[model samples]
Target chain A: MEKMLAEKPVNVNEEGYLLEFAQWDKDIANAIAVEEKVELRDDHWKAIEWIQSEFKKDSPLSIRGIKNSGALNIKEFYELFPGGPLKKASKIAGIPKPKSCI
Target chain B: MKNLIILGAGTSGTMMANHLVSKLPKQEWNITIVDQYKTHYYQPGFLFLPFDIYKEQDVKKEGKKFIPKGVNYIQKKIEKILPKENKVQLENETIPYDLLIVATGSKIAPQETEGMNGPNWHKNIFDFYTYEGSLALRNKLRDWKGGKLVIHITEMPIKCPVAPLEFAFLADTYFRKKGMRDKVDITYVTPLSGAFTKPKATAALHYLLEEKGIKEVIDFNIDRVDYENNKIIDYADTEVEYDLLVTTPTNMGDDLIKRSEMGDQLNFIPTNKATLQSLENENIFVIGDASNIPASKAGSVAHFEAEILTENIQNYIKGKELKEEFDGHANCFIETGNGKALLIDFNYEQEPVQGSFPFAAIGPLSLLKESKLNHMGKLAFRWIYWNMLIKGIPIPFVTAKMTKKGKQITI
Candidate 1:
């Protein structure tokens, strides 16, 4: 069933981290997915929260619509975290990067 | 031996009254202030009213609350200014003054624009400049589930140029929280081709607008408001249908200025931008929104003018040359929602440049850059405006002259 679900490939290469830690990832991802909110995996959560708190020079929530100003870019993030999407890792870490960005 | 009479008890007048009443010896010169309304509104507070951030009572208080004991307040409508005689005609009596200071501020004259005051004036169309309109729109927004909510500017030369953009940002946050972010579609319309008056500011603001998914209708000349058809028609006949329309109407000077043929066609008092003295007559002086000074007519500009005009008046009385020291200085706090804001400081000779404020190379507030510290300053100003600014207590190092101390280098 996991293989069949993985074959669909609905999200992207950027979200591959969920596949690596599929065993424990289900708990946090479920909470985020159920609320229709963006979920950050444990490691990814650290980056997003850090960027919002320290890296962001503008306002606190100013990272909302800004581009490339995020904790990690999708392309670089995907290359660095080949085993799993940082978002999945970020969520496990309790970080939330809004999926609202274009 | 001569008395000083100030017109309009708005922000500029209130400040001048406080400034002069404190400095001028009580028996030496009598100060009289005139206005039709007795309510003194925290004008900046009006921007937060519709969002429930500021309530009706929070922004409004009696005019006398801020006025000092020695200063006399007259609640009466001004009929006309006979500058040749140096007197102002009120409803039942005439006021003669040795020196007249015009601080009559501007107002939202939706009636002057075609089709603006039609059947749909406040029903489908609304303005947040007045207390009544803000409260009315707040109610409409509360029950509003979502549709095409368009924030528009009818024309240029509007007060608080950055406000409409802030309103759009807040509305986006408001809708998303109600679980209706997907249900609402927001659009921002402006008369300028850019999102803001200054180009650099526009580029920064434009990026935010795009990020928030707010559509931009640039260079739109609002020809008329078709209330029955539920659309705003542009000069070229382009139209945007809206379930709800919020706008900043064309601001005009006092009615007396228009009636007496002493102001521009839009009712703005004609004046020397450099000296802050009225052009209609030599003895009359204008400040704040009343003066037709092609600049952003904000409260900070008035504060800058107050510093110069108070001295200029003394110079005039001392039989000295009227100094040409007035340069339009306006600084504002732009709220970007989510507990952060932007602080911009600019003047007539210079557009807004990114730099630190109050000190050279060391500032708690950075210009052009956004920070949570700026947001705190924006929030703390309300207390300062009421207790410090209006009472004429000087803010350290924030003198009228624009210093380049904390300003960034232009390499």
Candidate 2:
């Protein structure tokens, strides 16, 4: 699906997660963060940057991964993104939702 | 003769030994498998063990019974793998290998969580991922007056991902059979978003949670278990109290991976998802829960990978291009209790769907939907696991790759 983010057309999934990392930018992330009702503060960007880098490296993201990441503690991670932090953070960072083999 | 050393004589290693013993020329290649333990456990039975559906004796046997006559089986601890040198360091001696297969599978590390392994360990808090834990939980469940029965998963990538859910379903059945269904308030907690992660599976199976009266606590990334308070505190500070906590703790690969400096943060080896070969070395192959592949760490996945790894090993020995043939296929029976089970056949690409299995329209077992025949298949799997699966015998009508013929993929 195509959606307007940051006043530019971008590819996103049904849940509004950006499909292409190349299409992601700070403005688009800010735009998605607003949609998720999360205000992008400095700490939030720290997590977003760390998670985006991990995503680029193809590391499976999880709360445990975040705890070991040194970017933020899990409590701060929850505080920054609130409910389902990984899902919202990945969306804001423009990565696919972390999945388990089901 | 060249040497082939397989670590961890569990499901994958034993299957590899059986498969390669016939395939590799005796004069050319010598095979040896090592594990410190003598007993080869039927691990899937651990799920049923707590409910008294299976006795302790039913799930274990001598490990030597499964290895073929031609292969050499060693009962000794493996210290580390010197992969660059193409050698393995055992407890007392160093052994060299032309090829190495690491099947040193994952296990529960309850110590990873704060207060998990503290005073409440195995008393109120329990894990059913091991023989000892299962037996302890069985004894606990036998006499316990139930209150809040929590079946929790601390993290993902746990072996047999559905076992906790199965535990909850069987608990419902068990309590009902014991005439104590009304007393036990069962809760299924997970770090995942829901009971089932895939689309079709969630759609088909979500009702079971409500139907069985099992409450769900989703997106629960547990920070610590406050044993004194009798509640699990998540990162968000959300607390779920329980009287009896059956948790699948942080499942990590063998510490030998850490000692060898060959694994990721979780100690699972990085491997080619399709080929099952270690990304770092061509000669080292990883299978089962040891590899950090995106496949579920289940015996069924190992069984499928063993088939592909056998072919790849043969290819590598002949100095040919490796076959990227493993499709992350897994076939599992999900016991839904009440004399019914759900048989799901899926791969890295496909989510389990509703349809007949093995046959296009005519199945002895149905997929996704519950059936008595599927339950029978679940019971019969124990015999198959011992007699055929570990012995490298191809199961009748079941292939290594996931078949899309009978499945209703679209709907």
Candidate 3:
């Protein structure tokens, strides 16, 4: 957490915009492990890491990938936070407010 | 009696309406103006609206207030035009005239982009070009806790090209005032190679952009908005995600021009280089954004055109030889925020040369130099636009022709 926060342009909260996708989404998705209900097993972290690796050059994560990471389906994952991952992740990670921002 | 019909009540049309009312013999010609909107906006103020420099009410007034008496103002949407028949078809009635003037200004048509006007419009993605968009952005900014705010321009040929830059500067100031400047990251995205159309202005503005710590992303040809993924992707595979996206959509001429036989591919009327008369049909004339002139599409250009065209129209009506006169002069006050601004004056033949305006070397506000005096001068223009410009009163010290006396001739 200290290392991610220490890195330049890593905090989406600081820039208010997401310059890189892997850093921005993963910033939020990685923090999901800290949440009380979330149990980010190696498989879940692997899935997010996979999405980041493929998408570092501009590939974005798909909803189907959540299942590949051994997490629930997209709907069940969204059911974790009423605000949903896109909105919650974006706000927490400091990605500029996407269309889904409440 | 010869009928003169103007197909808009915007800044240009209203100015022309007042000028013609004063110049033409009311006994000889009846002037009729058509437009759908009842409220007249100080369009220059739209740039200030999002930044809280100007409120919606501050820049708005009833359209009929500035309209001179004896000129009939009809609030109606124009459907089509038959230039060959010298007639305009509006929703309520068909206006037939001896002289027709098309002054309907251009507008942002995001629908031209495949995914531009999708579900994310005005919600996640906002445009500050219109009154509603600016007002909505004001609201969005108020509630914003602070984060990556992207000020993006879809394409150029937009009215007041410097407005987006002004927005970035003002946003920096606004967020700072709100104690969120530390958290806010402002990035300016443009398709242009520089911050401005001119090299000099870009160099000067680049310093300001750098001083403000605003990230600059140049030559971004945006392909589409992936709303599901929350990112704006370019053709070259560069994706910039944002918390909020402020975009200026593609500006195009009015639909009526397309309906008429006189307009170009983008629905802009093809007018003579010097004369504002329609190239396809001489009886018809177009000014302001609707006209496809090499001149910058601006209110100042329209004001200059109105002055020159009035004389041309009078000469044409008298069967006298038309003059190859108008030189495409356009001037603008670029707001640089912190109560300071810069002024740019140029014409068709000359680029925006670095020099003071009007008085030249001895200026209260420096030319091509940013200062508080220019900001105050810009603030004062609102009063001038309402009292003098729209009323057709000739602005002293200004003319249709570009004067080289005060300007530094560029290479």
Candidate number achieving the greatest DockQ relative to the actual structure: 2
Which residue pairs in model 2 clash with each other?
none
Tens-place lDDT per residue, model 2, A5-101, is 9999999865687778999999999999999999999999999999988776556778889888888887788889889998889999998776655
Candidate 1 per-residue C-alpha lDDT over A1-102 given as tens digits, one digit per residue, 9 for 90 to 100: 132221232221222223233333344444533333444455445454544343122121111112235555544443333322323334332333212100
Candidate 2 lDDT over B1-411, as tens digits, reads 999999999999999999999999999999999999999999999999999999999999999999898888889999999999999999999999999999999999999999999999999999999999999999999999989999899887789989999999999999999999999999988887777776678878888889999999988989999999899999888999999999999999999999999999999999999999999998999999999988889999999999999999999999999999898898999999898999999897787888898899998789899989999999999999999999999999999988899889762
Any idea what lDDT model 2 has? Answer: 0.91
- Candidate 3 chain B TM? 0.96
Q: Local error of candidate 3 at B330, Å?
A: 1.0
Model 3, stretches more than 4 Å misplaced?
A: A1-102
- Candidate 2 chain B has its poorest 10 consecutive residues by lDDT at B192-201
Comparing only chain A of model 2 with the true chain A, what is the TM-score? 0.96
TM-score for predicted model 3 compared with the true structure: 0.78
DockQ of all predictions against the true structure, Cα-based? 0.01, 0.49, 0.01
Cα lDDT tens digits for candidate 3, A70-101: 54554444544333343333334333322100
True contacts recovered per prediction: 0.00, 0.31, 0.00
Kindly report the docking quality category of candidate 3. incorrect
Q: What's model 1's TM-score?
A: 0.78
